[model samples]
Target: MSNISIIGLGGVARAIGARAIEGGNAVEVIGRDAAKAKDLAAALGGGATAGTFGATPVGDLVVLAVPYAGAVPVIAQYGDALAGKVVIDVSNTSNADATGLVTPDGTSGAQEIAKAVPASAHVVKAFNTVFGHILAQGGPLDVLFAGDDARAKASVSAFIESLGLRPLDAGGLEVARWLEGTGLLMISLARHGVGNFNFSLGVDLPG
Candidate 1:
C-alpha cells in the first residue's frame, strides 16, 4: 500500500483520502487549518492522520488537491520539503466561469506547478477530469494522466490502480495542457450537452 499525503481539505481532497484509505493506503491530510485537517483525517479513518501544514510530508506520493490558482503558491510554501517525492497535480486551469483556460497557450497548471516545485520532485497531472462525488462512489472509472518522468508516472499509475480505476497515460508534461482543456470540455458538456454531471470521460478500446 502507498503512503499518500493529500495537501488540501476540500471535497476533492476528502474524496481522494477516503478512496486511498479504502484502497489500504495510509493517508496524511494536510491543510492550512489544522483543525479541519484533523477532522478530515478522523472522517476518513482507516489509519488516516493529520499532517502539519508546510512541513515535510511523510508520504512518498503527495496529492496536490487544491485549486489551480493556489497550486503553485502552495508548492512554494512546501519548498524543499517535497523534494524527491512524486507530486500529483489534480487541478484544472479553467477560468471562473469554466468557459476557457486560465493558463497561456503553451503551459498548463501542472506545468506551472512543476516550475514552482523543487527540481527533485516530479509532477504528474491527473484526476482533474473526474467529479468528486462520482470518484467517491468507487467504480472502475478511467483516469487520464500526464507527466515527464516515466518512473513517477508508473508509480502514479499503480496508485490509480490501487484505487480501483484504469490509468491512461496521455504522453508527457506538454500534453497536460490538452488534458486541462479536456477538463473544461467536460464541464461544458456537463452543463450543455449531457445536461448533468452524472457522467465521466473515458475510452472504449475494441476487443
Candidate 2:
C-alpha cells in the first residue's frame, strides 16, 4: 500500500481520502485549518491522521487537492520537503466563468507546479477531469494523468488501479495543457444538455 498525503479538506480531498483508505493505503490529511483537518481525518476513520500544513508530508505521494490558484503557494511552502516524492496536481487552470483556460498557450498548471517544486520532486497531473461527487459515489472511472517522470507515473498509476479505476497515460508533462482543457470541456458539457456533474470523461475501448 502507498502512503498518501492529501493537502486540502474540501469535497475532493475527502473523497480521495476515503478511496485511498479503501484501497488500503495510509492517508494523511493536511489543511490550512488544523481543526478542519482533524475533523476530516476523524470522519474518514480509517487510520487517517491530520498533518501540519507546510510541513514535510508523510506520504510518498502528495495530492494537491486545492484550486489552481492555491497550488503554487502550497508548492513553495512545501519546498524541499517534497523532494524525491511524487506530487500529483489535480487543479484545473480555467477562467472564472470556465469558458476557457486561464493559463497562456503552451503552459499548464502541472508544468508550472513542476517548475516550482524541487528538482527531485516528480510532478504528475491526474483526476482533474473527474468530479468529487463521482469519486464519493465509488464509480469506476478513468483517471487521465501526465508526467515527465516514468517512475512517478507508474506509482500514481498503481494507486489509481488500487481504487478499482482505470489509469490513462496521456503522455508526458506537456500533455497537461490538454488535460486541463478537457476539464473545461467537461464543465461546459455538464452545464448544457448533459445537465449533471455525475458523468466522467472516458474512452470506449474495444474489448
Candidate 3:
C-alpha cells in the first residue's frame, strides 16, 4: 500500500483521496481545521486517517492539493519533515478571478512549487488540469502534468494509472505554463455552454 498524504481538505482533495483509497492505498487527509479533517477522513473510510498539521511525516507521496497561492506556504509548513519525499502538486496557479496564470514571467504553478520546496524533495505536477467533479464522477479522465525528475514522474503516473485514468506526460516542468493556462480555457469553455467540449477533447495526427 502506498502512503499518501493529501495536504488539503477540499473538493479536489476529497476526490483524489477517495480514488486513492479505492486503489488500496493508505491515505491520510490533512487540514488546518481538525474537525473538517475528521469529517473528510470519515467519508474516505477503510483505515484512512484524519490528520492535523502535526501528523507524522510518513507519506510516500505527498499531494499538495491546496490553492495556487498556498503552495509554497504548505511546503514551508511541512518543512524538513518532507525532505526526500515526492510531492504531487495538484494545485492550479491560474487566477480564477482574473482567469489567467498567476506566476511570474512565464513560470508555471508547479514550477513555482518546485522552487519553494527543499531540493531533497522531488516535485511532480499532476491532476491540475482536470476539475474535481470529473475526478469524483470517474471519467475516462485525463491528467496532464510535467516534472524534471523521471522517477518522480513515474511514481505519480503509476498512481494515475491505478485510478484507471490516462496520464499525459506534457514534458518538463517548463510546459506547466501551457498546462496552467489550459485550466482557464477549460472553465471558459464550460461557462460558454459548449457541451461536447466541456472537459473533453480529441487530437488528430496526420499520417
Best by lDDT: 1
Model 3 quality (TM-score): 0.91
Tens digit of per-residue lDDT, candidate 3, span 92-183 = 77675747667877787788778877788888888878888778887567788789989988988888887777888899988877877777
Whole-model lDDT, candidate 1?
Answer: 0.94
Report the lDDT of model 1 for residue 73: 89
Which wins on lDDT, candidate 1 or candidate 2? 1
Among all windows of 10 consecutive residues in model 3, the one with the lowest summed lDDT is 196-205
Across residues 37-69, which tens digit of lDDT does each residue of candidate 1 receive? 999999999999999999999999999999988
Per-residue lDDT tens digits of candidate 2, residues 1-207?
799999999999999999999999999999999999999999998899999998999999999999999899999988999988899999999899999998999999999999999998999999999988898899699999999999999999999998888999999999999999999999999999699887888989998
Candidate 3 ranges with C-alpha deviation above 4 Å: 54-56, 193-198, 201-207
Evaluated against the true structure, the overall lDDT of model 2 is 0.94
Please give the range of 10 consecutive residues that has the lowest summed lDDT in model 1.
131-140
Using lDDT, rank the candidates from best to worst: 1, 2, 3
User: How close to the true structure is residue 54 of candidate 3, measured as C-alpha lDDT?
Assistant: 43
Select the stronger candidate by lDDT from 2 and 3.
2
TM-score, cand. 1 vs. native: 0.99
Overlapping backbone residue pairs in candidate 2 total: 0
